[model samples]
Target: MRNSLRFKVALFFSVLTIALLLAQALGVRALAEAQEERLIAALIRDDMTNVLKGYQANPALLPPFDVRMNGYVSGADRESVALPATVRNLPFGTHEIIIDEREIHVAIAPMGTAGTARLYRVYDFNIYEKHFKEVINALMGGTGIFALLTIWLSFGLSGLLVRQVAGLARQVKTLRLGESAPIQPGKYDETELAGLVEAFNDYHQRMAGMIAREKAFTGNVSHELRTPLTTIKTSCELLEQDAAIRGKSRARLQQIERAADNMRELANALLMLAREDSACEVEPVAMAKMIETALTPFADRLAQKGLQTTIDIDGDLHVMANRPALAIVLSNLVDNAVRHTDRGGLHFRYAEGWLSIEDTGPGIPAHAIPHVFDRFYQAGSPDASPAGVGIGLSIVRKLCERYGWPIEIGSEPGQGTRVSLRLPAASRT
Candidate 1:
């Protein structure tokens, strides 16, 4: 959740709001405190000036004494108006000092006709300071509450900000390979968001055009190749009927026929892959019968290599699947086993909807196992012998994926290889 865009946006807003609010609170507090201090200091200075002038004009006139204000002059009834030691040493200026554990602001000025004696005017500001602090505390408390409210509002605002983006993502998820319609840019109100949707629509149209071209190319090529393949098969059949074609000549002719059949199957498989959906008809296929038919193509190769073969599938075992797709899968698996295994045998077994092919070939390398199903990926160095252009397993994987079948391959360096397919079970015929 922390990695989500909404979460990140909310966090960004939260940090920004906190910083702005804290700065605002501090700035207001400092400004208010400075203004109050300046006003209080000016009042003290004015009171001191008035008292000094009155005593200067009339030597007998005494300074006013009040609860919030008091005046005292040095060398004039010094014993009766006792001054604090801290106040007596003060120069002619305004000063703040503690008197009897209370805060006092004092303004000292010159007094007497000779301008030698100092006059001190004291103002006790403890009560006013207490009230000022109370007001500041309430302001700070309100600011704190407002800050929390702003943080909550930030989450809601962030969600609104990204709602269109989230909706775009949901639309993208619903898109199919080539069948989905483009998102309408007019749906979004923001210019940037509308532009983004337009860009996506352009990209989607380009991809769909490419897919259409590829499908057309594959369909045409497959259709065109079938003609030559059919002609070759028919010619081979006519040549085989003639008794003059014997021994090596007859065997070569058979090879040509087999090659033509394999070519046709390959073209069909490629055509099927190019289409968005399979065109092959689905039916209940007898597992053992399909295995026997698939082994026919590689029978000569197995005999040439002197390798054995075994089948342990029940005659009645059947699976619900597309026949041609399953045929291509089994043909590829058997062909791979035959190509690799030169010494030992091949085993085929079926149980609980899983059909497995076990080969005694020198097993695939552990590091290469993961990539065996990738298109055009072969084990060993480039200088080594090639392995059928490496599309056999890739085709099988694609077919299995298209049909929602589960397939797996397991092998060790020299312990042989095993490929398994879990098919949909059907009632025995």
Candidate 2:
């Protein structure tokens, strides 16, 4: 809750409002107290004047007056009046005193000739203190109510703003080329928010259009290339059957056949990748058979390099995957292994739900391992053999990701490299 924007805004507003209210309350209380003191002083002065005039007219009228007021004749030693020493020494003017926890306002004046007697009017301020307490209580109560209202308003407004931002974030997160609709500007009232929505919508549309165009281009190109690739493969097969062909011509024809077959496989893989839909059907495939099919195109090169290959899997062991995509993945791994290994062999192992391909090639550098699966990212030294473009592992990674297979690569310098893929348990079952 503390991390929430709404909570922070509300807390800030509440604190600011409470501080302002407290300051205003103190200022108002001070002003009221000052005005009340002046009013009390004026009333006390007028009442004292009246009492002095009454006493001069008739001395008997001074003893019994308003009970809230106490009159004292200084120098007469009136012991029943209960005046404090501070009030007794005060010069002839209005002053304040506290006696027995009760605040009193005192007014003094000359009562007779040549300082013979002095008149004192004392007014108890306990009633005024009670009233002041009531006022303070009311002010505090109102301040609390206003503070609560301010907090509620701040939270409500901040929540509305945060929700709008969250909505925008959710839209962006779920945005996909053909799956999500573009954001509508009219949904937002604020000018800046509307502008942002419109801008995102424009960018989204452009990106979706570009993707569609690229997919169509790739599909069309792959379709066009397949015809010639099949024709070339057929021609190579026919030429290899001819008895007139010599050793060099036959080898060249065989190379052409392998190249055409590789191109066809690559085209099929690219076509599969370019399609956005992932509704391809998966079926049980024998692990050994899949490995054998992948290794066929590289058999001549592997043999020429004097490299032995091993497949360690029970013939009954199988996995479930889309045939073409999985074939592309395996073929790419095998091709990379054959191209890079100078004199060592290839090994494939399948156990439970894990498949591993280890190659005795100069291992990938530590720095290059992280980027090995990036498109067109070649590993190893700069002087390494340029047998294949760097997309082989990238294709392998993509296929693994699409099928929800986890892949890991480990390598050590001059020791070789190992690639492991963990398929779903359901695939093995």
Candidate 3:
């Protein structure tokens, strides 16, 4: 009922094969039975004629008489036979009698005597039951040969079709996301499967065009936003330069300006990460230097909170990655850590090719670690609320993936939290 081609074909062919079998079986059986019936009928007719002639020649043959012939014939077959008799009296040229438990025709000719019938004779082909068995075996044997050929043809056709279908599946799997146009599959003319490939390719083309347009729009929005941020930051610096507003208001204005800049940077990161095809220039960024630059701006905040900052990074341990991305990652982390810790210290360390940041504030709960890097996923903690857009860690994870870096998170409730930045070393490459 589903109308799928393979199912329909299988069902139709199987039924056809069965039909062919049944027809052959019935046809052969009917033909053989007719042939045997005619064969028995002709023999009975001749034998009945001969016996009637012999009885007519002898007028002494009268009532309560019986006649028999040799039970076996040795030439064509070794089958044993039994002569048959009619239960009722007959007057005619032919009569029907049982030939070895099978109904067969016999001929009879009687002369003289009106109600009694003076002369009567019967002859039967008595091996009809044995002949029936032979015919059945022969019909069944022919059916078996035809059935085998049907199965072979069915398998051959299915194999040919399945091979081409499997090839199409393989090609579809390796299709790339960055191609400007969808793949045009190899054509198989005048086939329903070929039409299906064309339909899929048409849909793919439309989807690719839509994705490209979205990327262009997002990139344009990010660039447009950066221009206004730069102007506002410059205006803030000029406003802070005035001697009149220097004491308190000028500082507050600068902070407002800095926050705007951070927002602009965050927007840019979102744009770049939105498209998986986005590419960036990789550079060797000194792990220690990058951490120092990010932490320097937070130094005053740490000092005010009476929280110690420790760094155990070596001289020039480096990672290959986009510098702007690295800056955003560390900026968000250091900012979040400063906001979270009131008294306890924060430590930054690098070992092998991994940079780790650990904070003494109440760490993330174990259950929350799975979703900690997800966008807009923030546990109901004080740090998650303050200085958080919930997109920072998500951005960090994306950048780490672009850099071929693996990120690890370790946290325990009421203890501490540690985030590790693992980079593939130059030697590994």
Candidate 4:
């Protein structure tokens, strides 16, 4: 919660409110105290004048006295009157002093010949000072309450501020490529929010157009390429029946047919991968049969290398997968293993839902194993295989990702490599 924008906004408002209220509370207290002091000073001045007049008329007259006010007079000699040392020598003016820890405001006035006689009036309004403090404390308490309320309201306001952004995030999260309509900017009233929505809409349209163009290009290219391949395979079959094509000639014809078949498979795989809506129907596929079919093109190379082969899978074990996609994945893996292995055999094993292919080839380096599935990242030597453009494992990974299959590779420098696939488990055939 502290990391959220709403929380930060609320905290900002809370701090600002508290600071403003505290400053206002202090200002009000200072003003009230200053005004009280001025009022006391003014009353003292009036009392001084009255004391001078009363002494002139009656000679022994004293000034008024109350819980909040006091009066004193001094003789012309200044020593005849018993005045506090702090105020005795103060000139004929009002002055404030602390006498016995109590605040006092003293006012002095002159009268009689040569202004020798002086009237001193001191006022103590500590009682009212205490009440003033109580009022200030109450004001501060009220300010605190208001600040807290403002903080709570700020949290609610922040939620309203981010509501549109949260809604937009939900829409983007659920959006599917080339399936959903563009987000409408008109729904948002704020100019910045509307502009943001419009930008996203533009991006969505561009991505959809690019995907459509890619599907069209792949589809067209694959169609155009496969036509010639199909014709060549048909022509090879017709020639194989003729007695004139024998021995080496028949062998060459068979190789040509196999090449055409492999090319057609490549085109189909590329086409399926390029289209966004190319989800194929899944069914129970015989894993052993599919493996044998994938290895057919590599048979000659396997024989030439004198490499042994082991298939430790149950013939009746079937897996749930798209036939064409699984075929391509198997073919790529088999081709990679065959081209690299010179003296050792290829081993296939199945357990539970996982099918693993272990090869006795010069194993991939530990450092290079991580990038073996990356496109165009050749882990073998340049002369390893003519068709090793480094895209085989990349395609296998992509198909497995699309179909939710799990694939992993483990290898050591001299111990060969093992590639594992976690396919959907099906009932035994």
Best by TM-score: 2
For each predicted model, how many residue pairs clash, with residues at least 3 apart or on different chains? 0, 0, 3, 0
lDDT of 1 by residue, 1-429 (tens): 248788789889888887888898889889999999998987776766676777778867765432222335433222333346657666778787876677666677765566665566656677888998888898889888988887898889989999999998899899876676789988888899999999988888898899889978887897689999999999998998999999999988988997797788778778777776574567899999999999987888899899898999888888999988999999989988898888888999988778999999889988899999999998756797885778888989999988888999999877889999998779644
Regions of model 1 farther than 4 Å from truth: 1-11, 33-134, 148-189, 234-244, 278-293, 303-306, 310-327, 348-356, 365-387, 397-414, 420-429
Candidate rank order under lDDT? 1, 4, 2, 3
RMSD of each: 7.1, 6.9, 9.6, 7.8
Which ranges in model 3 have alpha carbons more than 4 Å from their true place?
Answer: 1-186, 279-283, 365-371, 380-385, 401-404
| TM-score quality measure for candidate 4 | 0.63
Lowest lDDT sum, 10 consecutive residues, model 1, at 69-78
List model 4 lDDT by residue over 1-429, tens digit each. 237777888788888878998999989989998998788776766666666777778865654322221334433222232457556567878876776787666667665666655566556677788888889889989998989898889898988987888788889998888678888888787899899999998999898899888878887897789889989999997998899888898888887887787678777777878765555678899989999898888888899899888889889888999888999999989988987788888999998779999999889988898899898898876675665567878889998988888999998877888999998778753
lDDT of 1 at 274: 72
Ranking by TM-score: 2, 1, 4, 3
> Lowest-lDDT window of 10 residues in candidate 3?
68-77
How well does each candidate superpose onto the true structure, as a TM-score?
Answer: 0.63, 0.64, 0.56, 0.63
- Model 1, global lDDT: 0.82
* lDDT, residue 149, model 2: 84
Against the true structure, whose lDDT is highest?
Answer: 1
Question: What's the C-alpha lDDT at position 315 in model 1?
Answer: 87
lDDT (Cα, tens digit) per residue for candidate 2, span 107-202: 787665565456776677677779987997798788779878877887887788677766777788988778867887787777887889988889
